[model samples]
Target: MKAESETKNQKADSTELDQSSFGLSALNFKLKIGFDGKRAANNLTGLGNYSRSLIEHLADQFPEHEYLVYAPKVKSARQIDAFFEKENIKLKLPKSGPFLWRALNILKDLTQDECQIFHGLSHEIPLAIQHTRIKSIVTIHDLIFLRFPQYYKLIDRKLYEWKSKSACKRADKIIAISEKTKEDIINLYGINPEKIEVIYQSCDDSFKTAFPKEKLSRIKATYKLPDKYLLNVGTIEERKNLKLVVQALKEVNEEYKLVVIGKQTAYFNSIEKEIEKLGLKNRVLFLKNIPFTDLPGIYQMANVFVYPSFYEGFGIPIIEALYSGVPVVAATGSCLEEAGGPNSLYVSPNDATGLAKAINQIIENPQLQKEMKEKGLEFVQKFNSSVVTQQLMNCYLSL
Candidate 1:
C-alpha cells in the first residue's frame, strides 16, 4: 500500500513539472520525432505491423530527420532490427523501472531527448507528455469495446473509454485507421472531425514479391496443404465471426478445404464444436504459429481469401491477399470495402448462403477470378509505402 502511494506521489510531481514546462515555445529547428515503441517491439499484431511499416518508410524516404523509438523493453528486437539499420533512426530502451513509474519515465525521456513531435502508435499517450509543450499525435485503431460492450468486461470497458477519450481530447492530432473509426470517435466522444485524419494501412512488402514455383511447392509440401483451399487469417475470437465461414463451407459442395491460421482462444472451441457437428473433421485445418516468411506463400497458394469479420478498423489480411495475387471475399458492415476494393466480392457477415454463393462464383469462373486478381493488384498500388508515408509526413509537417 505504501509503495502504491509513493508511486502516485511521484507521478503527481512529474505532472506538475510537465505543466510548468508547457510555457516553452515550439522549437524552430529540424524535425525530431519520437514514437511510443511498445507495440512495435513486442506485439506482432496489426499495431506492430503499422508501427514498423511507418518507421521504416519514414526513415527510408526522409532520412534527413531524426527518428527515435522509445520502448520500456523489447521482446522482438531481432524481428525488427532491420528497420534500425539507417543512421537517422535510433532505438531508445530505458533501464528497468517499477511498473507504475513507466509512464512518468517515458515522459521524462521524451523531454530530455528534445522530441518536437511525439506520435503514439496505439490509443495511448503519457498523461505528463500531454500537458507539456511537445506536439502529440495518437493513432486510434478502433472503438470496439465501446461499440460492442458485451465482448468486454465492465472494468475494461470503462478503462478503455477513459483512456481513449482522454487521448482524443488532449492530443494535437488523431490518426484514425479508417473512416468508420473516425465517425465513431465523433459520435461517441464528440471530437471535432477536423482533428481526426483517416489514414489507411498497407501490408508488408514481402507479399508483393513473387516466389519461384519450386519454392512455393516446397512450402506447400512442408505444410501438407491441400491442392485447393480457402484461406482465412486473423485471431480466433467471437467478433471475427469464423463460425460463419464454417457454415458457408457446408454449401461449397466441392473438394475445396478450409484453411484457418490464427491464435486460438476459448471461442475456437465453439468453432471446433460447429465443425464436429457438421462432420467436417477431415476438411477443416487450423494452423497456428506459422512463420512470417511462409505466410506469403500460403496466401499465394489459396484459391480465394475469405474474411468473415463483423467489424474492423481496416483489414490488413485482405490487402495482403490482394498483394499476393489472390482474389478476396470479405464481409460487409465495416471498412473492408476500403481495403478489398470494388472488385472483391462482399457478403453479409451472417449470410452463409450468400458467402458460399460468392465463393463458388469465383471458384467456377476462371475469367472472373483472373479479373479480380488483376484489379486487386492494380488497386493496392495506392497503398504502397511511398504514398502512405508521404501522407504521414504531411501530418508531421502540419504540426
Candidate 2:
C-alpha cells in the first residue's frame, strides 16, 4: 500500500528515471566505449565503487575493445588510480570546470574521441547525447528521492527527477541495478518494460579474497574493532535505518558492539540522541576514515553483518558480507533479499525486537553460522565477475 501510494504520487508529479558477450572469438568487432567516470575519480561511496569495479571487470573479461573512462578533473589520484592505468583503458579529463562540461559539452569530446557507445555509470547521460551518432546507455541506481521525499531537499529532488527523466528518454537502453529499481522506473516514468535490463552489481573483488589470519588480526588491531561486533556499512542517513540496529543492540549480548562505517550525514545527530537516550553510548562505534583496501579484512572479523535499510536499488553491503564468509541479517523490504540469498536471515526494518532475535539466533548457534557461511558463499557465486561482466558486455554490444 505504501509503495502504491508512492507510485501514485510520483505519477501525479510525473517524471522519470547485461551481460557479457558470449564467445570472445565470436564477436569480431573492437569498439571504443565511454563511461561516466567522474565518480571513479572523486566519490568514495557505492557509486564510485560501482563505476570502478564495472570498468575493471569489463576490461579484464573483454580485452578486445577499448575502454574510455571520462572523468572530470580531480585534485589528486585515488586508490583506484592503478586500476584505470591498464593498457586498454585511458582516462579523459575536462578542459574547463566540471559542471557545465560534464552536463553539456562532454558530448563534443565524445564525438571527437569517436566513442561508439557512451554509458552513464550513474543516473544520467549527456543531456544532448541523442543528437550524436554514438549509442547511449544509463544505469539507474534507485528512485529513493521520489519514493521517500522527506529525506531529500526540494531543489535536489526536482533536479534528480529532471535529469533522470531526460536521460531515460534520450538513451538507447536503460540498465537497472535491481528489479525493484526497474519497477520504480516504470511506475514513475511510464517507460516500457522492454527497454530496461536488470544487471546485478557485485562487490569489489577484494571482498572475495581470503586474508591470512595474521592480516585479519592486524586490521582488527589497527581499527580498534571490538572482539564481537555487528557490522553495518552504508551512508548514515534516515533511509538506512541505522537507529533500528542500534535499538536491536540493546537486547543482544553485552559483549557485542555495533560497528558502523560510512559517510556521515546530518541525520547522525538524531542517532546520537537516540543512543544517549537508550543508554548505549559505549555500545556503538563509528569508524570514519577506513581505507578501501582494509575494508574486507574488517568484514571478515565481524560476528554478523546487519543491513536494516528501509530501501535500496540493491543492498551491496550484504554481498560484501556474504563474500567475506560472514552471516547476514537484513531488512525485509526492498531488494536486500536479492543480495542476501535464501539462507541468510531477514527481519522488518520496523521490527527492532525481531531483528535482535534474528541476530541472536545466529550468534548463539555456531553450527548455524557455519552453515550460513557455506551456503551464502555458494549462493553469491551467481554474482561472480565472469558472469556479471559478460552480461554487461552483451548490453553494450546490443546497443
Question: Which one wins on lDDT?
Answer: 2
Model 2 lDDT vs. the true structure?
0.87
Each model's lDDT comes to 0.86, 0.87
lDDT of 1: 0.86
* Model 1 per-residue lDDT at 398: 71
lDDT at 395, model 2: 79
Assess the local accuracy of residue 39 in candidate 2 as a C-alpha lDDT between 0 and 100: 88
Clash list (residue pairs), candidate 1: none
Q: Total clashing residue pairs per candidate?
A: 0, 7
Q: Write the per-residue lDDT of candidate 1 for residues 94-203, one digit (tens) a residue.
A: 74463643456677777788899999888888787768989999999899998889889999999989888888999999999888999999999999999999887878
In model 1, the Cα lDDT at residue 243 comes to: 98
Where does the lowest 10-residue lDDT sum fall in candidate 2?
14-23
Give the CA lDDT, 0 to 100, for residue 262 in model 2: 90
> Which residue pairs show collisions in model 2?
18-391, 18-392, 19-390, 19-391, 19-392, 20-390, 20-391
Residue 175 lDDT, candidate 2, scale 0-100: 96
In angstroms, give how far residue 81 of model 2 lies from its true place. 3.2
Give per-residue lDDT, candidate 2, residue 90.
86
